[model samples]
Target chain A: MIHLQNVEKVYQTKTIETVALNNINLEVGKSEFVSVMGPSGCGKSTMLNIMGLLDLPSDGKVMIDGQTFEAYSDKALAQFRNQTLGFIFQSYHLINDLSVIDNVELPLLYRNVNRKERKRLASEALEKVGLGNRMKHFPTQLSGGQKQRVAIARAIVGKPKIILADEPTGNLDSVMGNEVMDILLKLNEIDDTTIVMVTHDETMARKTHRLVRLFDGTQVN
Target chain B: MIRHLFLIIWNQKRRNFGLILEIFFSFLVLFAVLTFIIDKYNYYRQPLGFEYQNVWSIYQDTKGAPKEEVFATQEQIRNALKSFPEIIDFTFTNSNIPYGSSRSITSLKKGDKEIDADIFTVDEHFASTLGMSLSEGRWFNESDRAAGYKPVIINGVFKEEAFGDEPAAGQMVEDYNDNPLKIIGVVDQYKYRGEFVKPFAGFFQRVDTTFAVRSLLLHVRSNADAKFEERLNKRLDQIASNWSFEINYLDEMRKSTLRETKIPMLIFIIISAFLVFNVALGLFGVLWYNINKRKQEIGIRRAMGASKSGIGRQFVGEVLVISTLSLALGTFFAVQFPLLKVFSVQAGVYFLSIVVSAILIYLIAFTCSLYPSVQAAKLQPAVALHDE
Candidate 1:
């Protein structure tokens, strides 16, 4: 489960101050697949980042699995992110220098997993995403859809409970987008993994169990 | 983790080749400078083998005088100098004084080995005047000249080279024309040249009357100074006005001899320091630029789970690996010097240079990588990912 109470995000510059997310409260239950839909500059990604603990809210208490994380140190936050949450960026964010399997093994590396076990787990995760055959291929050598698939494998490799995807299918074709959506749906239904996705597509939003819309830094529905 | 770091370095080898080459050349130059430093240090620690304190040399122009006049002038000078209580001892010779420039080499054979020995022709009092210590036999004496074969006293280095494991004092080695010369005594060490030069085989023979004595070495008392030298010169002039002498203190010559190596050593250190500094700056610039270029990759790793310190460590580890690869190539060539005995320096000194250079390069690489690595560590994953 994820909880955000009185969440406020402000982006300040020398000339102006912009409120990315105004005082709002929201919660997503365990294993629930939720989509946040918004137009450009509507604070959809900012809300997702706060939920993922990648960025802190200007004023809010973030509670995940009955624990508050507002006072967590940077190291503790990173550890929580590694152990409890996984991320899939709009750009895939796969390291081009490493192969697909090696990219998947990144999170486990921080856990001090031995090399052989990391390799085994990485291979199994890639297989789960139907990317076992391309495990040795680099991100540069893959198509946009395959790269996103590799990113998904990386996110799920450590078996984090909460998966935060920010426009995961934004760079892919319709067929590849549906394929990725199907994987996320199956993970939510079968593995009981909680998912929060930020997207602009109506069809993608309709596929999720619930939709929370944002317009100009406030929750609309 | 180190293996993974190595793999990353390998993956980026093409981008890192220039850095590797820079470390390679820097390491090579560092090794050479270190070897020269160690070699000179070892040589400087050895004793000069004779006391140069209170000793001075006088070069006389006897070529203008007739043989009888030259002999008479030298005898007159000797007697006059002996009368001065400040003058402890004096010997007349054609050339070689400590820190004085004159060399004569002769080849002498011991069994099948032909040894080229530095020959110093001096009178019976030359050894005592120079304060040379003997390890085996006596200095040149009156009985040595009349003992049949020509008498020669060799230093320990020459004795070891010409007569290994055998008694050198009673042995005889043949000259180039196959004439036998008896080794009368074995001196400990006779370093006439600067300390950087290796000790060579030396043969000191008694100065014969047939040869003209062109120089005089005086062992003056501790209080001897310029006034005494001025008075002695004036007295020598009175004895033979046609003969002009140039006086030089042996102590000053000794200091100048050390200065000869020190100046070059300083220049070498400055030049080497400049070169290493340039390499360090280049390495820093390259690493900083490379880290900026890899921000996205770093961001991805950070998002996945790498800590800030982990990122910094990875960057530093990559530079260390590249430097290690470069050092490997540089050291391969360096090892050949000791193996081949190139430059005739001691092998231990060369080995020590290799170790010192390796440590120096590692330190340079680590220092150069530090700031860039910390910058890499401070990069925010979300901001970096968003930019990409």
Candidate 2:
């Protein structure tokens, strides 16, 4: 579950001020899949960043799983994110230097998991994403679809309660996009995971449980 | 954490090879310079065994005069020096004086143990004039002229090399010609070749008087100034009108010898400093470039739950790992110096230099990685992800 009340973001410079998100209020129920649709520079990614706690809102309150995070230190926030949140970027930001298994094991490295347990869990996550055979392959050696699958494995490796995906399938073709979407849907339905995705495709937005639209800086619906 | 860092570094070995090579060469240079400085410092702190203060060496040039006439002029010069109250004591010796460039080396043998040593021929008053203390027995006296064996005073180093732990006094060792030389006494040490050199085995052979000597070591009073040197030179001219005298203060010669040893070391230090500076700059540049190239990776790590401090520590840890690898190779080569006995320096000096060089390289790596790592840590995760 997530809640945002009067969330606003502003980008300021010496001579100009531009509103990124203005007076935004939204809520999503537990285990619900939601998608945000918008054009370029419509503050859709900004709201997702605020929800993921990657960036702070200029003026607002944010609550996740019934707890306010205004007083959390950077270290505590990072730990909270490790325990409760997972993120997937559009470009599949897997480290090119690390193998597929190593990239998937990144999230568990910050936790108290031992190396053997981490390897086992990472292997299971890769298997769930149909990437068990490519564990030793590096990011550069994999195709775009396979890289996205590896990124998905990384996002779910720690079994986070909430997954924030910014354009998860934006860089893939139609077939790969449908496959990634099906995996996301299976995770939501079977594992009861909460996912909030941002996309410019109407078909992808229509596949979620609910849709929210944003134009300029305010919510349209 | 260390394992993770090592994995990352190992995977990127090709990219890091140049930096590692730079660090390895820097470590070798640091070790060489530190070894030279430490060896010189160790030599400088030792006692030179013979006092040089308020003493002057006078070199007598007889200009190919007759042997009898030269003997008579040397006697006249001795009497003139004795008449001067400013002179405390003076000894007539051969040309092998302390801090001088001249040397006379010969071998001493006892059974199968043979040692090469410098030999100094001086009269009875040599030790008293130079303020040298005997560690075991007495110096030579007139009674030694009647002894069956030729008397010799060996230094402590010579005694240890030739006689081991046994008492050197009253022991007999044969010279190169099989003539028996008696070790009548032991002086603690006599590093006559200046402070920056290793001590060589040496001994003193006694002469009866000034008849066969060309150098005079004069122990004068503290108040003996340039005016006294001028008056003494005039008196020496009157005593031996044909012979030329070269008067040099012992303290001044000691300073000149020290300068001669230090000039080359100073140049080496300057060159090493410049080299270290350039390596530091290269290290900083490489680290900065590495951070820039890895910005997306940093963003991914941050999003995956790495704290800012964790990111900074990761960068610093990577540099430390690279430096460790380089220093490991450097130490392998450095240890061979002492093991192979490449130089006359002590093994402890080489070991100490290795430790110092390793520490210095680590410090440089840490300092060079600091600012760039801090900048990497300060990057906002969202902004960094979008930076590509």
Every model: iRMSD: 1.3, 0.7
Docking quality of model 1: it rates as medium
For residues B193-241, write the lDDT of model 1, one tens digit per residue.
Answer: 8777678888888887776878889999999877987899889889878
TM-score of each: 0.95, 0.98
Q: Model 1 compared with the native: what TM-score?
A: 0.95
Itemize residue pairs with steric clashes in candidate 1: none
- Supply candidate 2's per-residue lDDT for B175: 96
DockQ of candidate 1 relative to the true structure: 0.63
| Residues A1-221 of candidate 1: C-alpha lDDT, one tens digit per residue | 99989999999999999999997689999999999998999999989888887777899888997878867777777788899899998899887777888889989988889999999999999999999999889889999999999999989999999999999999889999999999999999989999999998899999999999999999999
For model 2, residues B166-211, the per-residue Cα lDDT tens digits are 9999999999999998889999888888888888899999865444
> Residue B213 in candidate 2 has what lDDT?
71
Each candidate's fnat: 0.47, 0.60
Q: Score the docking of each candidate (DockQ).
A: 0.63, 0.79
Model 1: how far is A58 from its true place, Å? 2.6
- Name the TM-score of chain A in model 1: 0.98
